[model samples]
Target: MIANPSDVRNLLESHYFLFAFLSSLGTLQIAVTGSGIRALWLTPYRRVTRWLGFVCIITGVLFFFGQPLFVDGPWAAGSVQADSTTRAWGVASWDELAGARNVNDIHGGLDGVDQAIWFSLAAIIAFSVSVVFGALSIKANTKELRVDAKLDDDDIDGLAGLVHRSYFSNLPISVRNFRLEARKFWRDGVRSADRWSLIKIISGGSNQ
Candidate 1:
């Protein structure tokens, strides 16, 4: 695959569109994960955390495969030469080009391929680090929520208010008001004396 530098460059360049597509996919994945996290009453906390972790894994894999084209190095540096060679090869006979060999041919005469390989490895390492940090965050939040469950009503209410404010802090005034109404409904449910209502409210509030 690396027999010719031009061939390697052309192959990588051809994947430019693929790289863009994967990046778009990653962005969509993140947006969906964020939306899921915001719907606290609708989804369980552990499920959200697990889903986020899964999304990160998919994003990381895509990034590892797709980010090399954007990385600054030999891939960008050799573009002009690759383009010229591609045009020249179009006019030249295949046999002539195939027979041509350089005395300095080493490691299949493709230097950029080595750099891309290393960059891909670096991307994987970065992805691994992100997953580790994400997992730790999930663990810490899980522990905190567990502790919060045992707190008194006042403390729990205070914590709930804090969470509500933080979650809606970035929204517009109108949207925030709407979310607050929903919050009130959830709170009222939590305070209900009916057995079924209490169970449902507790499940929703605790999930958040």
Candidate 2:
């Protein structure tokens, strides 16, 4: 399905593109958590959800600095000049660009560093937008634990149910029956604990 894999590789190698991808994921996590929409959350644990967003932010920033942007002038004939910074570093000829374009007869496409740049500024735009959204998401979630508030209902029953169904929906009927039984047992234990705690509180009050 790929028309030009060389272009894809070059795009993927860009620090800006990596930042944008991670930032987008981070934003999505924050948006879902802050929106208090359990249906959209990736996991049942609010702490895990928040941690995922933070992880994304940290990951994006780390990747953004992994490589510096490379710049070269457009070709006029058989050669093009490198950018001022590049030229200052002693690379001024088009031979570097030509060598990059030389395809391998056996494997095909340019070697790792030779792939040409496409959509030069598009990655930057994506990275900037992702950073903005990630910041906004963090701001929105900072006022309150929106994800926790949403999960407070029946201790994240909805979120847990969603995960359980997604993973085991295709399993045999016997497994499904066992899952229901296990859930019932867990709920019974919770209720027993609550009752015992209430009883202890009344006994203590009576003694006082």
Candidate 3:
């Protein structure tokens, strides 16, 4: 059986709707997933992804623009399309088709929309993958910070000489002597009288 012009129009309309739905899905994913990933990366791939999605949406819109399937018109394909150009801007009549047609008669040709689909598809896919990477990146960062904190604690402990690297024959004796001297420094008898009264207390100011 031969395909009626109306049937052909319907088919195009179906395809346009499907593409529109897919384009919307991709755009949504790019936004949600890319934003999720954005929290982790010092740098995000969003600029490129945004540009790509914009291109896809524009391309899909232009492709279905005032075509027989998308607009309200006498043609069979009219009114079947998803008027998706950020504000219903596309071919809505046969006369508009003249402008949509380009180069060898392609509707969504060279002007960015045609080139924008692949970019959009890739960007959306990349963003989906990035969501997982972001979570892993955060977990790894937390673990690293933990390790750093533990190492710092260990270093501080060592500086206080709680752990000795080597044992010299007289080391313990020296350490004991050092401790004794330190304790003596804190004792009242060890501190010289001249060192006292140098600090003026707020309440003692009048007496001074």
Best candidate according to lDDT:
2
Tens digits of per-residue lDDT for model 3, 1-208: 2224343334444544546544664465356434433322222344654565566666666655544435433232232233222112233466545433232112222335534664566446554444444344434445443454432342232123211111121235456767776788778554554344446344453333
Q: Residue 208 CA error for candidate 2 (Å)?
A: 74
The alpha-carbon deviation from the true structure for residue 144 of candidate 1, after best TM-score superposition, in angstroms, is: 3.0
Task: Evaluate all candidate structures by whole-model CA lDDT and list the values in order.
Answer: 0.40, 0.45, 0.42
lDDT for model 3: 0.42
**What does candidate 1's lDDT look like per residue over 1-208, in tens digits?**
1225556354444443334333433443354346533222222354554455456556655554444334432223223235333322222232333222221224133255644664465445444443444344434455454465432233223223323222232134435556777898888875553445656676774332
Better of 2 and 3 by lDDT: 2
Cα TM-score per model = 0.24, 0.32, 0.29
- Among all windows of ten consecutive residues in candidate 2, which has the lowest summed lDDT? 83-92
Per candidate, the number of residue pairs that clash is 0, 0, 8
Look at candidate 3 and give me any clashing residue pairs. Answer: 66-91, 66-92, 68-77, 68-78, 69-77, 69-81, 70-81, 71-79
lDDT of 1: 0.40
Candidate 1 clash total? Answer: 0
